[model samples]
Target: MHFVTGGAFNGKSAWVKAYYHMEAEAVGNWFSGYRGDALPEDLHSAAGVIVVLEGIEQWVKELLMEHDPKSAQDMWHAALEKWLQWERGQQGRVVCLIGSDITKGIVPASEEERELRDTAGRVFQDTAAVCERVDLIWYGIGQQLK
Candidate 1:
């Protein structure tokens, strides 16, 4: 698995498209890309494909509204576990998770917003630990983090 992260408009997706030499679309069951406000219900369906998940911060924000703090955290953990397991089960398949680096900015005033920020940070850290490559994009330049 690969983790690609950066602030908004940092060109992470552009870099990924160029590096992979393909657009974000389903191609012969080998690749799929998704950008949505919420996590897909059937994550395992993407098994055996190079899956790219964008706008993860948005998904976290959505989660914050629908559940309590602990519940939201549990949902995040469950989703991550599913993705990790799917990646492990598929040889030669890559999972590229893309999330904005929201923790660099000012701390949020609302408790829910603050929790969202913290959750995103913790998720990124944990995911990066297991990923084969971690890239941080800044002003369109990608720096390898791990």
Candidate 2:
């Protein structure tokens, strides 16, 4: 698994697509929470060698709003484990997760927004832990974080 994170419009998704040479013309293996795509239930039968899941912050906001913090986090971690297991099931399979960096120095004024930020920070930490590699994007440059 590879985790990529940076501020919105920082080129993380473009970098990943270029890095992987993601050329599929159709909605073959690329998915995004921004596009309303749910986290895949299983990658066992996915058609491509790699899958890209972007807009993780959107997913986190949805989950954090809908469920208790612990429960939402558990669901997220379970999905990650499921994807990671599927990636390991095939020798060449990869799961690339792209999240916009929402955890920053300034805190949100609203309690709800703060909660979302807090949950997303923990979620990103957990994602970094499970991923084999991590990258931080700025402008158009990508720096390996792990």
Candidate 3:
């Protein structure tokens, strides 16, 4: 799977969309979303392309707070690890991920903000292990990490 990750506003989504459109036109198939919240299940059926959003650490932290605030960090780790294992079980296919930069938020003055940043960094590290290709984008430049 290909991972498109970088700091905020790096245009990962735009890049993904452009690739999807170009691929669709070249093959005459519809691009769809699968495996994430942004798209529907019909995407898995079309077979052209599937692009999905991976959770930014902040979102995971917020979810933990909503579900179990006392042990949010532990929960985020367990949940994310489980989800990654499940995704890996899908055999072989191109899985593209869009992620946010969580480390930059460490400067926030609130406890929640700190936790979000930490959680996000951890999530990114965990997901990176599963990626076959990692691209870092900065100011419209793409750098391959894998």
Which candidate's lDDT is highest?
2
Candidate numbers, best lDDT first, in rank order: 2, 1, 3
- Cα lDDT tens digits for candidate 2, 33-143: 989888776876578688888888899888987798788789899999899888988788889999998989789999988888988989999999999999999997999
In candidate 3, what are the lDDT values of residues 1-146, reduced to their tens digit? 56777777777666666755544322222222222232222224434334344445445655656664436545645644554554465664355666767686338898877766766676677667767778887766778898
Residue-pair clashes per candidate, as listed?
A: 0, 0, 1
What are the runs in model 3 whose C-alpha is more than 4 Å off?
Answer: 20-49, 67-92
Which residue runs of candidate 1 sit more than 4 Å off their true CA positions? 24-37
RMSD of 1: 3.0
TM-scores for all candidates? Answer: 0.82, 0.94, 0.64
Comparing 2 and 3 on TM-score, the stronger one: 2
TM-score of 2: 0.94
Question: Per-residue alpha-carbon lDDT of model 1 for 40-86, expressed as tens digits?
Answer: 64556664467777777777777777886567767867776777787
Q: Which one wins by TM-score: 1 or 3? A: 1
Report residue 17 deviation for candidate 2 (angstroms): 1.0
> CA lDDT, every prediction?
0.74, 0.87, 0.57
By TM-score, the best candidate is: 2
